[model samples]
Target: MAVLAVVSVAGLIVDDRVLVGAPIWAKSLKFSVSFVAYCLTLAWMLQFLTRRRKLGWWAGTVVAVTGAIEMVIITGQVIRGRRSHFNHQTPFDSALYNVMAGTVAVLWLATLILAVLLFRSTIADRASARAVRIGAVLGLAGAGLGFLMTQPTPGQMRGTSDIVGAHSVGVPDGGPSMPLTGWSTTGGDLRIPHFVGMHALQLIPLALMGLVALGARVPRLRDERIRAHLVAVAGAVYAAVLALLTWQALRGQPLVHPDGATLAAAALIAAGAALGSIAALRRPVGGNRAGTPERTRQPVG
Candidate 1:
């Protein structure tokens, strides 16, 4: 992870010039940093899942190798002064793109397997367990959205272009973008949901950790089940929001824009998720505290 972080920084410096409007290595740098963070978060969650079984080592290895392959392809393409994604300019480029896509598919499969393991395992802190499970599920959903980005836009299919798709809807690729993320500011960008969904592994667990810390400071929140319920609710709502974003982008609506339809949908999703969470809180999944050993119990953070 540390090595990847260093490589990400080096990419930013080496490819300082703008290639397709954005810095040449911008995508490479972003992928590198995101994967590094991903590796750390996955390793942390695996610690819990692997306590009873050793399958985590194999899953982690798959994750590490896939991530490394993706970074290599992205960085290699950037260094060659071409787009890393959606490019089919040459036979070699097409093959490279397909290989990277295959690697990502493998990574997602490994993640799903690990998530299932985490869900079935018994843990002292049910809250952390639930958070990890929800994170893994949402992360996979987000990754599934990547397929939408692979399809060509209506206009692109009509043209004789090497690349089949573009990230931006209304705006052309390599046009105006948001600062660090390079997300389209002038048009709907499918990458928004992809980015949001990919980070659930980190965000959900972090939110749970925050609750755990707060519970330590407050008397009423000492019950780990209460924290678990809250985390579950947050996860539900987070999933709804990701779906909403994907819907909005598909409609060619920019992230900053919110029409009456979008606002109404968001409100409905929030209410539905909240109601679901409340119902689940009443019926806890794991048995009440008796099975969990004292040595196994620890602060979620």
Candidate 2:
């Protein structure tokens, strides 16, 4: 993770621009490289945790698949420049990028489906399961809405200053037009929905963790005794913060503006540590046999 972070920072320094002016190939390459590096780091961390706990393999698999799709998309973008076959560009690059994007979208849908399945299994209890299911449904719906927002509106194609931005690269004169709004063109293209949708992947999982943690506190749930209450609560708080950020994005708020996402994330991290300490104190101290009931011998009497 540290290595990826360093690489991403280095890429940002080298690019020295946001989403514009850089050659199409260079821009795509940089973005994809940074994104893939980050995703892989996250996947590794999640895998490590899952291995230790022996839980949530399915969730880990979803994360791994998501990372793989991200890599493939980045590869296609880096190789293909900005043009695709359907957009009237050269067939090879265009076809590959288009196919890659389509495949990614499909995989994203599958990820959502798998999340629902995992939620069901993890929650187990009826009420907790229902809460998780609702959160998953909201996340999927939000993603669909965001996808629609990525398409070019009819009026947007004709002319609009809103499409222009500080970092936009205009299409080469007479070059093949991009069918999508932000990718093929330049300007103030609203990508808020896309941002929201992508973060949903994180938000949904965190929400599930929260639900599970809360369920553990319930008197009736068997899994309530499971360690990790703090982890679950911390996850829930983090998810809530992400959801707020998503709401801000959906409202077209600027990313850098103070919306409290950072503070919230920090708080959650601190709380997680505290909760973890508390949970550790409550854990069973000895081997399984020590906690099991001792049977008395009857034959001697």
Candidate 3:
């Protein structure tokens, strides 16, 4: 919530048009929100580990390193913008951003590895384990795809005259202007992949919930029912966000194409949630047995 508040306040204070033009505050706010979310997730996972089974300390360390790298990137961008005399671009800023992005990619890969290990250790039912595995795969795939799809081409960094023209809209040469929607593809096209990746936070947890719920219905797994229900409801909400993301992708979106891939992913997540829910519901109660000999002997006399 603090992170959200920062984003909201900064967004309001910063001129929307200037903010759209690779503004420092905007980037800072984004980093803050992402970092906060990451922290909260890590905290929850750590708590789970402590109460249930313990995950390696290395996982927490890796997360901390990644968070630190991200902070450096955000700080570098902020500093660069502040120090620029007459809108001069600094090589240091560009290099720091690249380094930060590269580090994040590495961290994401590490996260996938850790998630896989956790999945292996998870003694939960098939549904919960499957959800964790799927989420990890998605994160890994998204990062890999992003790196492959966005390879920088020659002359990619060269600024266009149109950018200067667009940046000049409704503002004095040095003053802030009204935020325009389409001019560059930096923020626009990037939204797709970012949205797809981030939504996993919701999708994965929810999937686990559904799994727990299903497991709870089984006589042997019934003890885990409460955990299952909670996770399933969470997964449902995440699935809804995935639907919204699909819509965002479809409109010839710049950063991330709302294409077949996005739709396919959404379908897969929805299917998992549905199947898990069904499995949970079908789980036999203690008093109301299933596949018993007594029931099979019915109508014999």
Top lDDT model: 1
Off by over 4 Å in 2: 1-6, 15-63, 75-88, 122-135, 155-190, 200-301
Q: TM-scores of all models?
A: 0.88, 0.43, 0.56
Candidate 3 has an lDDT of 0.47
Total residue pair clashes for candidate 2: 7
Taking every candidate in turn, the Cα RMSD to the unseen true structure, in Å, is 3.7, 11.8, 9.7
Which 10-residue span in candidate 1 carries the lowest summed lDDT?
Answer: 292-301
Ranking by TM-score: 1, 3, 2
- Model 3 stretches astray by more than 4 angstroms: 1-23, 46-55, 82-89, 125-127, 143-145, 148-150, 153-188, 207-301
TM-score, candidate number 3: 0.56
Model 1 pairs whose backbones collide: none
Q: Give the TM-score comparing model 1 with the true structure, all chains together.
A: 0.88
Clashes of each: 0, 7, 11
lDDT of each: 0.80, 0.43, 0.47
Off by over 4 Å in 1: 50-52, 269-301
Residue pairs in candidate 2 whose N, alpha carbon or C atoms collide under 3 angstroms: 84-94, 85-94, 163-187, 163-188, 164-187, 164-188, 165-187
